[model samples]
Target: MSADGGPVARHSPARAAVRENDTVRSSLEPAGAPEPIGSMLARNAARFGEKAAVRHRSGEGWSELTWARLALDAARLARFMEDAGLRAGERAAVISRNRAEMIVTELAVMGLGAVYVPIFAGYGTEEIGRLLEHAAPRVLFAGGPEELEKVPLDRRPEVVVDYSGRASGGAVPFAEALARAAFSDPGDAEVRRFLERAAAVDPFEPCLMMYTSGTTGRQKGVLLTHDNMLSQQRALSMLWDVSENDRFLSYLPWHHSFGGIFEKTTALYNGALLTLDDSLGKDFDRLLENWKEVKPTVYFSVPKVYQQLYDHVVTHPEQEREVFHEELRFVFTAAAPLPESISRFFADRKIPVLEGWGLTETSPCCTITDMAESRSIPGVVGYPIPGVAIRIAEDGEILVRGPNVMRGYFRDEEATRKALPGDGWFHTGDLGEFYGKALKLVSRKDRVFKLLNAEKVVPTLLENKLAGMNPYIRHVIVVGSGQDFLAALIFPNYYLIRERFGDDIERAEREVRESLRKTIEAFNAEHPVKYERIRAFAVVSRELTVDDEELTPSLKVRVKNVLDRNEPVIDAIYDPSSDCDCRFLRKVFRLVPDSRKCFLGKDKTLDQCHTCGRVVFAEGAPGVGEGSVG
Candidate 1:
């Protein structure tokens, strides 16, 4: 802690601070070489033939898929698609969660040079229908009857393959499709034709059409080619040393690039065994059980999963050895900034915490944290990986140019033009600055809002700080925009609050609010900048949910949806006369005149009010208590 009460950015081993440089491009040159995804799979199948290529929980135990089997199955599936009229350059969509079949479908579609479009499994019937119409895939692979039902009978593709064995709804069972396309002889005409087509596939042509997560706006289909995906693998092969001996336990959805392209591609390209985590990160107990079985060499997930693992190991010390086994190399986290505590935990265990930064259009990996150095600051997402170039725009938005960058948004030239100007640099819309050669992310360009006074506010900075302030804080959304002062809607960790304060609802709310009030005061004092410090905060009664459109499928909060849902609470914050059922931080603010002292005639400074004279006391305010406004 600094004397001013702000967090001091200290290196772990406490090394001398290096001077920040202005270099923008990656320091390392392009290493290794790119290989077509189809070719890479064939090469691996020959080298690691009969070795476990993928694993998943079977009926009572686990089932393994060998490289030879995986390649053969993918080939059979590819043949089925070709028979179903899914020709080259056509799109094939899959709506499924992580499983052994997802990879098979991926390889099948890409092997025939067809575009692979993966829809989020959590998408509603309406969203699924809309994307299916837009993608117009010749073939659709659904996880089961649930996803298959999402597509209207009239709107269903020419062929539908369901992973579930049941053959209802005109959908062929996945196994049945593979069997129908199977040939007895390896050198049969069908097999030879499939191989010839796979070799004829143009690596530069579009092989993937992934939709953006759409946290802030509607989803746009981003078209990526095989070269785009393979380039990232080439870059990582230079930095990482994983081989076929390594193991991976993955739950991240295949619909997104982080899991689909980055994690899954690494496993297949390197011949490593990737166990499909059925838990999908929702059930930690099941995940821990899988952890004991898989003992992954390199784990990749979000911070929430890491926090759960950390909490478990901290409480159950005996399980530490199993959780952090000898084969464990390093852990990678992204999608959001990781808490310093979680990074420290891994660093203490001699496991480097790797954080990467990029957009879906960049094949999701442009920069990676240096493995050689100790963990730097929490937000520093290290130097650019090999073959990628990063440039900080004058306005601070990160611009990227590389083979990994997408060709364009599918069928949306306008959107593509805006993202990728004629100059070749793709605008990432994420704001960041260089710390020496490493990139430290700020806020999303759209998330930065200006107040009525024209003072800009970066909410993510305040949000991250507030999140680390208390364990009870599950999520925080700082809102001020065009208003005189900033405020926050904080979702508390309900389990922890109930554990501490017990079942009485009102009592727990009251106690937690009081505790949060003290912490917010300290946060305000530490951040004296008027626009940065949160002047008011309300403990949100309910948690945000994906069903309510408050969060994306990847669990990213949709800020616009949050604000739209909490309009009343926001109105009440600015206008205290409005009725709102929220409990605000008590005694943290006071309505005062132009004077910098308390309106209650106490020897209190503006620091005590925490409002910095930006708020005024409205008469007959509904929740005002003495000098404070609830």
Candidate 2:
């Protein structure tokens, strides 16, 4: 039986009915039955006072914070925040790279019953403005000056606090704040009162405003409460055993659910050691280096990270096997359905890869494959976790009712109504099926483009970027819906190509590929956002025509026909092993740093990025190989 496949054992008296009812899929441990994370922090501090709660890298070397010290510091920060006039349920934003201060500041804010809005540190001025406008935080807690700098002058918060002690534009240093909170007069009447406020926080009150990439062209705030998050700990406890002895290597974004609930909160609740993703200036390889130093037993990452590890393992087979041997208990992956090959690769080395599926609305995890389940099944997302009931709607969309479900979208009753259609059934827009007992995803109901990480992608914006890249690129349609990376079906401006590079069709093809390659490379460099990068593309020589069922009456490219017509070619690009031959409708495109320079006949040549696929184009006349593409 899967970890989810267990008889109900623990719950409150009110939920005892849920435990007995076969219809209500109650968790093995009653959801929302355990104390909140705030209490867990207190429990952990008392239980494991001297033990290191977390580890990170400073300018000099590695640094750590003991549980007792972390609790004290967090409490101090909360007291300092209370002195700064931050009231309960108020909002606070934290913009920082992956660092220890991120966790410290977040926990501190949450402890004081304030909402913690975690924005991606690298967000540009526009993104920063949008989030600030919605959140309207009382005080902005940032890592350093650079983070505060990202906020546009017009959208600056009322109070800016640099938790990293870096000075920038009217922001107070964290050290100063802490010192003031500590050195206040012993007779100050408000100190004890404020500490009492922090201690008397309600577990069900909304404490997090996790914003999701709005599919409808605006960011939506998903409100998570203490009870919603607390339920996550007890729910997943049935699957993976997080012990005080266990160490977790965390690099996933803290704003994202997997990192926040699975690793961060899990670490605190279990009194385990959490090693931050101290990559030292965006150098992800530093994570691998740190892993060697702190061999964590349990590791959690997204599909992208696992894919990157696959690349490393392939590049350095011996070293990878040495690092990922049997010592590592579990490497949990979610955010997207992983290719079976990845699960097999780790399995071959005696390392287990646990695949899971969830949305930001569900505290990030709903169905996670445990020891009983196998990732070998391609689309499996495992059975619904304990205390979560899954039912399919008439239109095939997945409907979930669970304690992990969020209260609602912040200040958007309409969206909340649409998402949670009352009677406790929340509409999860994703289509799912049961592969026996496990939940296997099918497709999405809406046109919202979710990349490998479930982050929404704007189709029109990406298509425009590609079309503007090369003059020879006439029509570009971004495909790979619900897949790992984006791929494009491009219609070449053959007339312009021939006019520029002579009427030799063969020469034109080579030059077109070269120009297309350069355009993609520039795009990758300029606006290389995660989950939206074009890792592969295909070019078709035959002009798209309405008569040929490729373009619509208004001359717009018909997406369905284009995809259906180029199904083999698209499949060939993503999964080349099935095709086995390097033959496509026109040409295959892949993005990489170094490409192999291949020579066509008559001293002409084009470079092929070998890393993107399993096949290579035949070194022949490119013009003659159009409609009869093999």
Candidate 3:
């Protein structure tokens, strides 16, 4: 049984004896319940007093804050929050880019027994307002006055703490609060009171209320206790070895669980040095510069960032040594599947590429590729960590039960009941299968949609196939729900296009479009199933962005947002009589009847179809069409 009085299920070691209703779990027993967040910090502070707990860029060089100093600052911040009327069980929200203060803020909030809510920096004003209203925090901590504008006036918290070190809009400056709390006396009354409160925090009470990315629907608040976060660390400690000698350069935002609970706490819990990466995964040039300065022992990031890093290292061979330095251990990637090519690049350099699969609802880590393994299998996220149990539902959905799972969704009992049905397993909504002792992700249950004829199509399978078939296809989203056949929206690799096709912009676009057309035609011919074949496609003009709400912060495509935004393009693709002149809408329009199809091959364009003589021409094809798309 778990420390929370929940039943703990175990699985078999041998795969051959497995049954349909078997529950898979780690061989090791679950660890005992952990101390509260404050107790862990105090312990770490005593052990590594002078050692740098956190590091951040200060002007031309880096500034270090020792573990002892971090503890002191946290106590100070907690005292300040207490003075502002923030109490136990109340919420305190923070909106900021990654900095040392983020770590301080979390410790302070959790120490005071108040819930910590980190808002994604990429969220817009309306999204920010919505979240603020829902959380209804007693105090809000922001990066600066600019973030203040995002919060609606009526929804704004009563107390605001600005990190800019200067007063703005009647908000308390973070620097002033810390400076006021700084005391030469080791036994200050406020600090003692704060420490006492921290030690008294309940292990099973909710300390975090992180919201989901809201890709599928409105974001749900996932309530997790101190034990949920600490239990994950205990599970990881069994599979891997970590210590204070390690260094981490972190940029993953703290708003999401992948970074907030998993990555960030992984470093702090192990007493590792976490450098605040200012780049935030945006500016690669700056990232490489920081990489040279602090050679991280273990790295965590998404596949896209690794791809970019791989490209850079391949081109600049000298910098390869700096990135994959001797002290560097394994690289951990999650949120999306890592392309085999990029994984191979790291493997070639003797760096193991570790991938994981989970959701925010599970404290963000259910399975991680084995630390003993060097090469990763394409889609397999390995065996469950210690204390976790995995079961495959009849419908192929992945189900999990573990000490690390969240308590429930805040203020949404319906969602909580649907997710945790009193069977001890939390419905993951992901489709998967067992690959030996490991788990291979199939697709999201909702991603498999039906056609007008009722045949099902797994969009992820087709998307992966289309993306893998070409070097220039950066992203592919398969679309055709309730339609006759499948179609795709392709985003191109413009960097490769520029390198191969050179300075002539129009010629480059035309040549790439023709190449893609042939690829799609060949793909259609290869797939014999009528429902599986892709009959129409369009290469989007630009890549999707977080600002446009087409992508989540972790870079997952927001499917509904993508579909809604491209309704016009989709209409043109499905409409038989529509002749579109929009930019980048050049299509492989095979969905219509053959009599209306162009007889001329992709290479040779004409003004009209050979059979019907109906006006048919490529939008951007020079002299072949009446109008140009771009």
Candidate 4:
């Protein structure tokens, strides 16, 4: 039973009975509910055996894996793992990109009642080593040589399988593992008996050990039961109208909950086809190439990726513009707040970029924007999914009660107690509001800081507002603690600035700085408050990226890291003794132009402010901050 005294069943009537005025209920026929994870996979495999389960693009072309094929691969892998001395509750870790083999590994691990741990492919060797130490996986599967190299030599698993063959040395190739297992063929009888035994397992059995993104500190492994994963998948599927026919274009890191559960498992459980894209950073062009060929109906990605894609589209509007309008049905954004400008950009082009909200602890899908709703709210994350209950506590923290919530952080009782309250609902550290059946995330409770005057400010809200002010400002972070006023660290779009200033980089910097200064001055004039007004700022020339550790794998800004790395720059901004330095501080401008302006000709500066750097009245710019330029 949940702490809220609610019955912990396969389905909750309370969730079903919630007002469905703008809600879309699950079309999946209610059943007696098989024992969680493995059963769910088995049921889908049985019902949709011949359906295209997963599709992966290779040099040759698209390689399709039917549900039956996936089941067979998973069964074979399971038998191999069991034969290799894997215990029922032992752990198997997969460090890979989005690939068919990764999915097969997950299914196999879960099918045998063994815990599956997925390490992000983007993680450095040190980060991967830490997670490996924490999870202590008996067997580790690496996607390629790069991922395999990340595995510590001292802690090397008893069994190491490389799916991509890019890795050399003692690791066994994935093909050899399958070929070896084929000779022994666990047989239909043994496979069925193993599956049945696996199905008999309880819902509370831990199926995965997902590690947090480690944004704050050392990452802790989060243990999620089969019920937790399924509940989230079922809830999100119902909310998003996902069906067996729906095709999902997956690019997000497979290790994160959003990608692992919402994007991957949700599609698999519904018998939908998952198109894998391994070309994340090495070749973004290849990702678009895959998209052109796959033409996925549904896509899930982080805000940064969407921002980049929007930039790409805006810059190259003539290239395949019609295809995006006709083929792309819906796009979902998570891991960070979706800027209204980005959302409106897609909405104007007939692409519904829905902003959703969740955390690592909640299996990552608690609320999502509804596609069936009359209008998509730009900033709001829509309503809670079916079977999920959400409420705003008196103190403004968002409280959620659902089966999707994790059992707890693995072996971290103190952290678990700190996260899950004595009350039935889990305290989401985030502050949010429920308006007209929509949920709007405000800021993290821990993120709120006080100024010298004791005025409380939410940096996230202010940053979002500032970033929306102009397309040129790529990323903004407000910084101040026990200080009289707030300051900002701004990363300007070099391409946009250069385009604006022609070939002269110095002129571009000056123009960008002056524009930023005027915008901040105007904002200060309007706000008339120390905490709200950004007094000083430093324009960063470089872009924040996952590789640089300035951003997480999900592409969220690493606030502490950013601040730590640029401490001297931030210090110079706050120092009032120096005037010229302060002038640079007040308006530190970079040479980069907004990526959005790269494609659009310099002749049409539609939303650009003449005097300020802020975006003015562009034809269809969304959200507040219209009328006079900021």
Strongest candidate by lDDT: 3
- Roughly what TM-score does model 2 have, to 2 decimal places? 0.70
Cα-based lDDT for every prediction: 0.76, 0.67, 0.77, 0.70
| Candidate 2, 259-280: lDDT as tens digits | 7666688787777788887662
TM-score of each candidate structure, all chains considered together: 0.88, 0.70, 0.89, 0.83
Task: Sort the candidates on lDDT, descending order.
Answer: 3, 1, 4, 2
lDDT, candidate 1, residue 387?
66
* Candidate 1 pairs with clashing backbones: none
Per-residue lDDT of candidate 3, residues 187-293 (tens digit)? 45655566667867998899999999877889999999998888888777766666777788898888988888888899999898899888888777798889888
Checking candidate 3 for backbone clashes, the offending pairs are none
For candidate 1, the clash count comes to 0
Identify the superior model by lDDT, candidate 1 or candidate 4. 1
Candidate 1 or 3, higher TM-score?
3
Which candidate wins on TM-score? 3
